[model samples]
Target chain A: MKARVHITLKNGVLDPQGRAIANALHSLGFDKVGDVRQGKFIEIDLKESDKAKAKSEVDQMCAKLLANTVIENYSVDLVE
Target chain B: MKSAIVVFPGSNREKDAEAALTEITGTPPVMVWHRDTELPKVDLVLVPGGFSYGDYLRCGAIAAHSPILREVKARADQGMAVLGICNGFQIITEAGLLPGVLQQNAGLKFVCRNVNLRVETSQSLFTSRYEKGQVLSIPVAHHEGNYYADEKTLDELESRDQVAFRYCAPDGSLDPSHNPNGSQRAIAGVFNRTKNVLGLMPHPENAIRELLGSTDGRGLFKAMAEALAA
Candidate 1:
């Protein structure tokens, strides 16, 4: 089984790196971009065969280490 | 007074912290490695600044899970004093010993310079030597020193008088211009609810000697040493 984790800064938290990316996109003439927020995408391979168990384990990882709950939020998806 | 300095693999400021603490207390501090699960009995645990674990996946996020921190956390809960500077501040916050998180500077640039900080409260063991509202010149060197916290947590921190220091103008005004990293309410340092754990972005160890252009940071070490002796 495999899992993917998406970590993103909370809505109200300041995202300076995302702002820089947005500015770069604007400078490149991609004016269609209104507001942009950047986030982290992580994929992990698990030896566990149970999809349910894999998701629960990845969820724990997100809460414990993958995401800093104070400033960022994380979501987990298990791929069968 | 006895002290131990925690040294992560990528930490480079342990020597500076050891030098500062030794100069102030007349005793050398033990350098504890990240892999060790036990810490020698000491009055204080100093987490010095540096790019711990190369600041991967967020600053201090990797090093926060190091084995030694478990001991540090236990001792902190037992009322032992723990002072975290620069990257150390990020680690303690990630370890849940302190509230809030440090984000990148608003300008997305690595800011390095001398900034003024107002001693917010002298009630904690970390800032007892400085008078409330006294401004001290300290140097902040980092890219992610901008502090962030939710409104409710911010209000709680303020009302409980847990804020240790705030970035301010030389004359002590907290205008936006004086905030170098865009920290919430210009907070430069914070104390845990118990007041024994302190996390601050500025490099107080770098400002301990007069030859370093300012001795303003010495007051913090003095306050800790005195508190331990008493």
Candidate 2:
């Protein structure tokens, strides 16, 4: 089993790095880019075969370590 | 005052903190490694600045979960004084001992220089030796020192007098231009709701002696030592 997690800064939190990336894209002539936001993607391999248990474990990981609830949001996906 | 400095693998300022505390208290602080599960009894515990855990995942994020932090957090809950500087501030906040988070600098560059900080209040143990509104020149060196929090939390901190220091001009004016890393309301340091725990971005330990270009930071250590001794 495997779990995939996506962590992103919450809306309204200033994302300077994302803004800088957007500016770089604009400078490179990618005029279509607007309001870019950056985040982290993490994949974890798990020994648990139960989908419900794996999801719960991964959720705990996100809440405890992967995502800081104060400024970021996280979503988890599990694959068997 | 008896003190301890938590040393993470990548922490580089533990010596500076130890030196400052020793100079002010006439006693050297114990160095506690991150892997340790117990901390020696002490009046204060300092989490010094550095690229802890190589700033992996997020600044202070990984170090926040280190074994020793569990002890630090427990002692903090029991009214022990905890001071977190720079990356230490990020760690404590990530550990949920403080509100808000430090994000990337708004200018997108690492800022390393002296910034004027106005002591917001002298009521806490950390600022008792300094007068309210006194301006001190302190050095802040971090790429992610910009402080961020929701409006409600900011209001709560303000109303509770949890703001310890604010970046200001030489004359102690809260001018936006003087803010080095775009911290909210120009806040440079903050106290936990109980005021026993303090986390600030500026490195007071680095500015303790006159030869270091400013003794303004000595007031903070003196204040803590006096309060703890009493």
Candidate 3:
């Protein structure tokens, strides 16, 4: 099984990295960008075969180490 | 006085913290590795700075889960003195020993400069020298030091005198002109409910020596020594 975790800063929290990316994009001539929020996309290979169990385990992983709940939120998707 | 300085693989400031302790106590501190499960009995614990575990995922997040922190937490809960400096502050937050969170600098830049800090409360074991509103020049070097918390929590911290330190301008008044990280309400350092545990974004260890251009940070250590000796 495999899992993907999408971690992003929660809304209303200032995202400096996102702001820097937006600035770079604007300077690169892509002015259509109104706002940009950069986030982490992590893929992990797991030995667990149960999709349900994998989702829960990955959620725990995100909560424990992958994301800071105070400033960011994380979700996990599992695939066989 | 026996003190132990926790050392993770990437903790470059461990020696500096130890040196500061040895200079004051006239004895070197025990350097506890992150993998250790037990902490030797000590009067103080210093979680110094550096990119622990490469700052993976988030700053201080990985190191917070390190094995030794379990012991640190247990002792801290018993009213032990704990000081988390710079990246160590991130660990303290991630470990749930303190309120609020430290995020990326609002300027999106790694700030490295001497900043003026106000001693909001000198009643703690960590900061007992400065009078309330007294300003001290200390250096701040960090990327994720923008402190954030909900309004209710901020109100609670303020009402409890837990707001220990604030960044100030040269004239000794709050100003955003030099709020390096854009920390909420210009907060630079804060204390837990009991005030035994302190987590601050600025590096007081860096300011302890005379060659660093200021000895304003020595009072923090001296105060701790006096508290422990009492």
TM-score list, all predictions = 0.98, 0.98, 0.96
What does candidate 3's lDDT look like per residue over B1-230, in tens digits? Answer: 77899999889888888878888766688999999999998888999999999998788888899999989999999999899999999898899999999988998889998999999898888888678888888888888999999788889999999998998888788889978998999998889999989999887777787887888888888888888873
Listed models, DockQ each: 0.87, 0.91, 0.82
Q: Which candidate would rank higher by lDDT, 1 or 2?
A: 2
Q: Pick the candidate with the highest DockQ.
A: 2
Pitting candidate 1 against candidate 3, the one with the higher lDDT is: 1
Per-residue lDDT for B60 in model 3?
89
lDDT of 1 by residue, B42-149 (tens): 999999899998999989999999999989999999999999999999999999999999999998889999999999999988888999999999999999999999
lDDT string, candidate 2, A9-48, tens digits: 9999998889999999999999999999999999999999
The C-alpha stretches of model 2 lying farther than 4 A from their native spots are none
Give each candidate's fraction of reference contacts reproduced.
0.86, 1.00, 0.93
Residues forming the 10-long window of minimal summed lDDT in candidate 2 chain A: A11-20
- What is the lDDT of every predicted structure here? 0.92, 0.94, 0.88
Assign candidate 1 its CAPRI class: high
Candidate 2 DockQ category?
Answer: high
TM-score of chain B of each: 0.98, 0.99, 0.97
Query: Which residues of candidate 3, in runs, are more than 4 Å off?
Result: none
lDDT of 2 by residue, B1-230 (tens): 89999999899999999989999988899999999999999999999999999999999999999999999999999999999999999999999999999999889889999999999999999999999999999999999999999999999999999999999999999898999988989988899999999999999998987887898999999999899994
Clashing pairs in 3: none
